[model samples]
Target: MDNIAGSKSSLTWAVHISVALLVALWLFPTVGLFVSSFRTADQIATSGWWSSLSEQESQNPFIRVSGDQVQEGDLYVIEGQLFPETDAEVSAWGTSSREPEAYEPGAVVDLGDGQSLMVNEAGAFRMTSETDMEGTRLPRVFTTATTPPEFTLENYEQVLGGGNGTDSMAQAFISTLTVTIPATVIPIVVAAFAAYALAWMDFPGRALLVAFVVGLLVVPLQLALIPLLKLHLGIGIGKGYLGVWLAHTGFGLPLAIYLLRNYMVGLPRDIIENARVDGATEFQIFTKIILPLSFPALASFAIFQFLWTWNDLLVAKVFLIDATGQTTVMTAKIIELLGTRGGNWEILATAAFVSIIVPLIVFFAMQKYLVRGLLAGSVK
Candidate 1:
């Protein structure tokens, strides 16, 4: 009892730690980029957008009417100043466009007309006119507002419109789908047929073919890229959607077949034999008996192939690098954006999230099948 309890405790701890680590690892960059993407360029440069909600102070420039002050009970007062107190820089000054800030703040200077003015650091000024100088105006004050920081979704909007980055990922996303979906589907279609044959059919070279496919599983895709590209070119296919789909299908087929065959071979021989005795042809048995029993395997392989093709950059780059630039995928477009718009956090975050969304949905939708498929034929 104690041993079982201890094992349970250890397992619970392991799960808790794993969940915590995964959440932290995934959330850190995603949250940072999300906050940064909404920040303005200046704000992003000055300080972290995570400080957007904090209070800030800056200097504001304003003009004060020096003559507007009146003597009230032996008190001299001036209401306005030429600058607001805070953190701000003075860029340009103009006093008749000739003598800007001729007299610094806190200086009492004469205007050479029986008029004197006192300017303070707070931008307030007091002017004692010889005779209530009517119709006289004060000099205009100019100051820059040193805004703290701000965030906006303009980067995301521009990226979605394909105007902010090298190549718009939104278009590339569709193109990727155009390539990935077919690439994923074709391999499964072809591999399912091959798997059924290898599992049930009696052929002389069947063992050799299965071994060859398994051997092909270890062949690095990078090693085959150039040869495959040349093959596509030589076949007059050039680089296009079809080429990418075929390339992914060919590359993804071995594992697809191997996995499906393993699961298919595990199915009860009694069921297959009974189907054959029932006058069901091999094709009908495969379509009806074997196919239904192979759902778990199919779903598992579909998830793997879909995710692999979706995230692929190199194959898409090699097989779809055409002159028209019409064959680019999301990964390639995101690469281009990294080079051109590296500072665009909104674009990066939105693109990252967009790319992840499909895979996540695929995983959740087929998770049950993944487990079931892995266990298929193993029990019997």
Candidate 2:
């Protein structure tokens, strides 16, 4: 009874657990990136995204007090707030880095030569000196503070450039779309025709051709890159959108044909026979019958091609991107940001989220077709 065919397995719980784990593994970083994109640099550096909603308590770097000294009854007074206008509460304060938390909030420290400094939990500070001290160095304060959660759209402003239109990811985004749309569509179109021919047409060398395409799947693109590039150069299509589009088409075709051919071959033979019996030409049958029915497979290939070309850097570097360095894709722009603004994590996160959002939308929108398409010819 337990081993009966078509009955649910007792270990189905294991499969469910495995899938849940995989989803969590893939989802955590993406959600973190999305959350961090809305966060300020200080907030991101201080706490993880999971804790972003709560108050953050961390030891801040030292801040040097700066303000003009006021003369009051022969004594010099310097008054200021370390975290002016913010809701951060200083828990502990210290005058020296070595003893950063030596003093509790509101404790007063006596400096030599008739000077005294007092810091409260609200981050307000006042320094008093018995003698007039106009030309004195300021004291540095190290503080441990608890700050309220902060979220901002400034990261988006910097990445998208709002409206000023300079040094923004917007241009790179458009360039990426320009490259990816053509790259994805061209291969799908060419492969559709080829796949249908291979699946339905009784042509010579069909099996061998299918074998060749399957073989090409294992041939890494790197092996033929230089030679193919040289061919592009020889044909006077050197280093431009057209060259890159053709290159992506060639590189993406094998898998496209293999996938579409397999799916198309699995379609009911009776349908193709009926269409041909009614005097429907191959093109008519393909456009009307095959294409409409093969939507799942087409969408599956589209998603894969779109993702690959959108995130591609190597091909764009070699085939696109002229010497002026004016035409950069989003991936290349992000690399540039990493090099130039390495410490600005907020900017990187925002730009990364911008790049990822489109792909995520595409994936989720077309995901229904994905499994159906990939598994089309596997069972029957």
Candidate 3:
């Protein structure tokens, strides 16, 4: 008992540490991307998100005067370019919504010949001259020593609002769903029927057929893309949703049938035999007894096929083209964004997170069945 308790304690500690590390690993980049997505382009370029919580530095441009000095209550005013001479690269800045940057806490600037000026980082400036100079305008610049935290949601708005210069993934997301849903559902429906027949309907060469389907699983999907696409075009189904659906259904069927068959064959022989004796048709047995028992397998396969079809870019690219580019799916659109707006990390992060939402939903919905399905109709 003591040994078992000690082992359990060690296991608990290990699991806790492992989970903490995993959470940190996952959260670090995701949080950075989330914060970066909400910031301006220049802010993202200049500072890390960790710095956004504190003060920052910035700059401003202004003007100065010459040949006049004005004294306010015994303070000599001297003013010139506090900012850099030219538009050079800024080194650092502070961040605070109030006061921003206060140089000498409200001191005055004295220009040569008795002119003076003062300004805060809030674009507020002051100037005085003992006597007016000949020139009409004086030039000056103010450098910002600091600023405060800033954020924006413009990146997400552009991605979802359908007006970011290109066709937004809003349409592509729906298009992917249109392709993925049916692609996942059809194969499972058809493969379930096929799996049932292969498992229970004793027929000639059944062994050979199962072997063939199993063999197909090892065949790389890339090997068949060109040939299958040629067949699609030859059949006049070229480059459309229907063609892509059929392609994915075909690709997903082998494993679907194999997995469903294994699960189905494990069903209790006596139950099937009793159903056969009770005058229930094969269809009746399948629908009533097998399907409910097979929920886990079906749910598991649904998750796989759904995720694969949802995330597919290469297949959608080849088989779903159209004249108006209306058929492009989210994956393809994201790839296009990577090529076109490669520098925009906000857009990239938004696209990635958007693409993941559906898969995450599907996983959560079906996760209970994933393990249950694998063990379905087996123990009994």
For each of the candidates, give the backbone clash count.
5, 0, 28
lDDT of 1 by residue, 83-150 (tens): 44333334332334345545565666665666566655554556665554556675554333334344
Full-model lDDT, candidate 1: 0.72
lDDT of each: 0.72, 0.88, 0.74
Model 1 / residue 193 / CA error / Å: 0.9
Tens digit per residue, CA lDDT, model 3, 306-373 = 88899888888877867678888888888888998898777877777788777878777777866565
Worst 10 residues of 1 by lDDT: 85-94
lDDT by residue (tens digit), candidate 2, 1-380: 55777655756767789999999999898899889999988889988989999999999999988888999997899999999867899999898999999898887899788998998999999999998777778778999999998899999998898465444899999999999999999999999999999999997999999989888877888777799789988989988889889989999999899889988998999999999999999899999999999888998888888889999998998888878676789999899889987877898899989998898898788887766655752423
Best by lDDT: 2
lDDT winner between 1 and 3, please give it. Answer: 3
Q: Measured by TM-score, how close is model 3 to the native structure? A: 0.76
Which has the greatest TM-score?
2
Candidate 2's C-alpha lDDT?
0.88
